[model samples]
Target: MARRGVWELEKITLYYCLQGGSSQGTRGFVEERLASFAKENPQIQFETVIEEGHPEAVGLYRNGYKRTLSLRNLEPIEVHDHLLYLRNTWGEPEQKHSKISYGVISNTPSVQGYWRTEPDLEAPSSVRRSYLGQIPPNVPPQFRSFAQLQRELGLAGVTELLQNLGCSKWVVSGMTGVKVKSRKKRD
Candidate 1:
């Protein structure tokens, strides 16, 4: 008779935790669910590697194990910003408060800065129209009020508003050769 060889299976580790008020119940529920899930799906096996500390969880993931649950939940805005930070940290800072100011340049044409304002009109109405054109034509009735527009445009915030009616940040910075300085801090 020929001798048979035994194959060895590699071990996998999984990380999970219970947070806040119902940690005990949450931990029990997760353990029960995972056990049942593993039984139902044998193709994917999970083994609890460690039960304590943030370093342990990080190690599990680093060592090729999957995390079972998020440690915390964030608001929609917070989630958006967090993802934005992960993707890229370089860019104009996010607009927080709106401010409005006006000034004239010697070589450059006179333009408005800060909150929404009328255009010089002498330059060209097309440019002005395009700047204001960003406003959606089908604005809901509730948001059609001037107050709503002001709020949406960031006109009532702490930062000053730019007056160039037709120029967007791109055009102002690129075409007219104006530099925009953001007042927000970079993360």
Candidate 2:
């Protein structure tokens, strides 16, 4: 997108209906601002076509690529911005974008452990902490670990108790690795 130059755009055509309500802003833009814009961008040919439809701005590139943008109900400034955007574009079809995860990327091994929102699912039950730091006095000794509390009350009940105790999401998330030991043993 950075490499796209305005010089690549050979022509810009603004289509509008002379009497349509949706084309009112475009009409005003053509009448008041388009002349100056054309004068400023002397390299590109600016043409205004009066048609019976909603207003639209189209850009034709030197590579035979074309891009169109709806100008319906847009103010003169907005129309100018759209034109500027069109001038800078390569007229390529839109592509799907992946979600960007913000985290430290390093070639070397991290001195401190990497940050995690959720616990390691593959870790053994004994390896995972039942709670974050020390347990508070309000919590009973019988329910020393979050796993013990979860077994007696179930997940929903445990969540309610945590909420009532004013535990934040971070606190609960920290204890997600807490898995209770099952009575059945593998041979």
Candidate 3:
């Protein structure tokens, strides 16, 4: 998707009503102009349906996404413009963007300047070694299991235990975390 290649509308389903305000005129214009346009583009297939509703153009792409443009009360030139728009575009939703800058390669950290290509050039820790956030490691007095932590503190103790372990999605508490809830209160 980064480097877009030549893309043409795979299929054009022109739907128009048999008896309507502008449907008849739109259908006539399509038969005369748009039908031949599709023929010129061999990769594009055209089909006209006499539906019971208003005139509309439904474009089908190879990626299985469909786009529809209502051709209500429009002239042949206007309909042609809309058709060209659909044919050229990928048929995706439009979003407003002020400016687009190069995105940092995902693995490369884009936030704080903590990343370095050479590991040896890294800075040493700025905090104390005692509670330097070394977690899941045996913190002498800290509870390692959720049940043990709950017994001493309470349910909120289990939450704090998880928070201490970096609170990342990859970090998860085991069944001990849930089974602790079912235990009767200690009198």
**Which candidate leads the pack in TM-score?**
2
Per-candidate TM-scores read 0.23, 0.51, 0.47
lDDT per model, in order?
0.36, 0.74, 0.63
Model 3 C-alpha lDDT per residue in residues 1-187, reported as the tens digit of each score:
1116646468888888878987866776776797677766777787888878889999888778898999988787888887788788775667555458443447766566655575432124452122222344543343345435544665355456655654533222332122222223458
Candidate order (TM-score): 2, 3, 1
What is candidate 1's local distance difference test score? 0.36
Name the regions of candidate 3 deviating beyond 4 angstroms.
1-8, 98-187
Worst 10 residues of 1 by lDDT: 1-10
lDDT (tens digit, per residue) of candidate 2 on 27-52: 88998999999898888899899999
Better of 2 and 3 by lDDT: 2
CA displacement after TM-score superposition, residue 90 of candidate 1 (Å): 27
Candidate 3, after superposition: displacement of residue 104 in Å? Answer: 16
Ranked by lDDT, top first: 2, 3, 1
Q: Count the backbone clashes (under 3 Å) in each candidate.
A: 17, 0, 0
Better of 2 and 3 by TM-score: 2
| Candidate 1 lDDT, 49-162, residue by residue in tens | 435432111112222432223323333334233322322222223445535533332676546544447633232457534443344565545334532443465432312244
Score candidate 3 by TM-score against the native: 0.47
Distance from true location, Cα of 89 in model 2, Å: 1.3
Give the runs in model 2 whose Cα sits over 4 Å from its true position. 1-6, 100-187
